[model samples]
Target: MTRPVATKVAFEDGWKAADTITLDETARYRRRMVMTSDNGVEFLLDLGEARLLRHGDGLVLDDGRVIEVHAAPEKLYRVAAQDPHHMLRLAWHLGNRHCPSQIMEDCMLIRRDHTLRAMLEGLGAAVTEIEAAFDPEGGAYGESHGQHGHHHGHHHD
Candidate 1:
């Protein structure tokens, strides 16, 4: 049997989901891929452009079924500073390194990395390991840089 294709994403509220698909941070960003729902329903996610799917977002299939997106729990570091100013400084350091972080009022969440953890600790930030769903900022240039007239790529060594 052919898999149902999801060509659209529904951001508006009030749409009931037939099933849910949990994905990690990396898996949440995609343009075209085959995905399996938590309840075992398989579907194709085929969009015109890659998108950062957020928790609670719905993937609308051609057959009118909606599958909810769930952010899967991941191992991460919760970084906190002595004060707001310190926190901002820490955030700046993280951004300078182009680290994807989830900024919060009291703390920041980042994927677990020994180097980053040591750097943050050296900078006077308290780092604690935890497991939680991560929803990071889309960056200053947004998800796609085409609108900004330039393309910036991230490389990890």
Candidate 2:
């Protein structure tokens, strides 16, 4: 059977999805792939390049059906500094290590690692474990998944 093709994209509040595709951080980025929804609805996501799909982006099928993309929950570390200056310093260190981190206003989230945990603690940043959707910055040069692809206000609660 020819799977439904999703060519258009929608931001979180724009479209109501007929179904949802929960994907981990790694599986979310793709130019072409077959995805099966929770209800067993299968489709093709051909974005033409690897793009980071955030929690509420939708894939619009040719038949006007929408499949919402949800960021799957994962174990991560929440890091916070005592002050803004310290936070900036910690961010720099994480960036230097090429860590994939979700930079929030008050804290940052990264995949938990003992070495990284130790480093952050030594740097005077508090580290805590949390379970949430992991949506890190793509990079200096990365594909903008769709409209409002820039994750400005999206963060863990």
Candidate 3:
């Protein structure tokens, strides 16, 4: 069977996906991958380069089928600080440690780690354990192609 290559991403107005593909952050970035849908349909994810897929975005198959992407749930720590400055500092610390964190309006979300949790608590942050889909900042270069945005540059393979 010929595998379908997705050349476009649609945020809306696409055909309803017959099935969904739930993926974590690490597995979401890909140029080519063989994935099975929730309904057991096999398909190929062939893009221009390794790219991050977002929830609700439709993978436009060459055969006119659209596959929906879903962000898989993960264990995370929701860190909240007494003040905005403190929260910002915590974010900076996470960045310094090369940690992927999801920035929120009043809190920050990072993958749970005993050391990091202790550090956060030590810094006067209130850590709350939670399970949610992770969609962290993509860094300086990949920042443009954020959660729902598309990238147009070469990505290291």
Candidate 4:
């Protein structure tokens, strides 16, 4: 049998997905890849360009079936501060380090890093290790999936 191909993404709601694929933050960003649904159906994902797949987004298959995107739980650090101002300061520190962080009203979420954890602790930020889905802010240029378009083609280390 021929494999199904997913070439489009549907962000609108109300479409019942035929299957779901749970992926971590890294796996959710792709331009082309072979993916397997949660229930064991495999398909090819071929998009015009790499994009971040958010939870609830649907991968539209050639056969008209939608495969839902689910964000899988991952190890992360939940950083909080004594107040909103302090929280902003903590966020600044994370941003300065170019860390991918999910900024929230009360806290910030980032992937676990020993050095960063130590820095946050020294900065008086309350850092707690937790497991949750990470959806970081988009790139500086407003593009999702953290692809920073630099004139010099600089890459993130």
Report lDDT per candidate.
0.85, 0.84, 0.78, 0.85
Model 1, 1-157: lDDT tens per residue? 8999999888777999999999998999889999999999999999988877877778999999999988888899999899999999999999999999987768899999999999999999999999887877776755741222321221111
- After TM-score superposition, what is the CA distance of residue 50 in candidate 1 from its true location, in Å? 0.5
Local accuracy of candidate 3 as per-residue lDDT tens digits, 88-120: 899989999999887777788889999999989
Model 3 earns a TM-score of: 0.86
* TM-score (all chains, Cα) for each model: 0.88, 0.91, 0.86, 0.89
Task: Using TM-score, give the best candidate's number.
Answer: 2
Model 4, position 103, has a per-residue lDDT of 77
Clashing pairs in 2: none
Please identify which of the two predictions, 1 or 2, would achieve the higher lDDT against the true structure. 1
Error of 1 at 38 (Å): 0.9
- Cα lDDT for residue 96, candidate 4: 94
lDDT of 1 at 150: 23
The Cα error of candidate 2 at residue 154, in Å, is 5.2
Model 3 off-target regions past 4 Å? 13-15, 143-157
- Model 1 gets an lDDT of 0.85
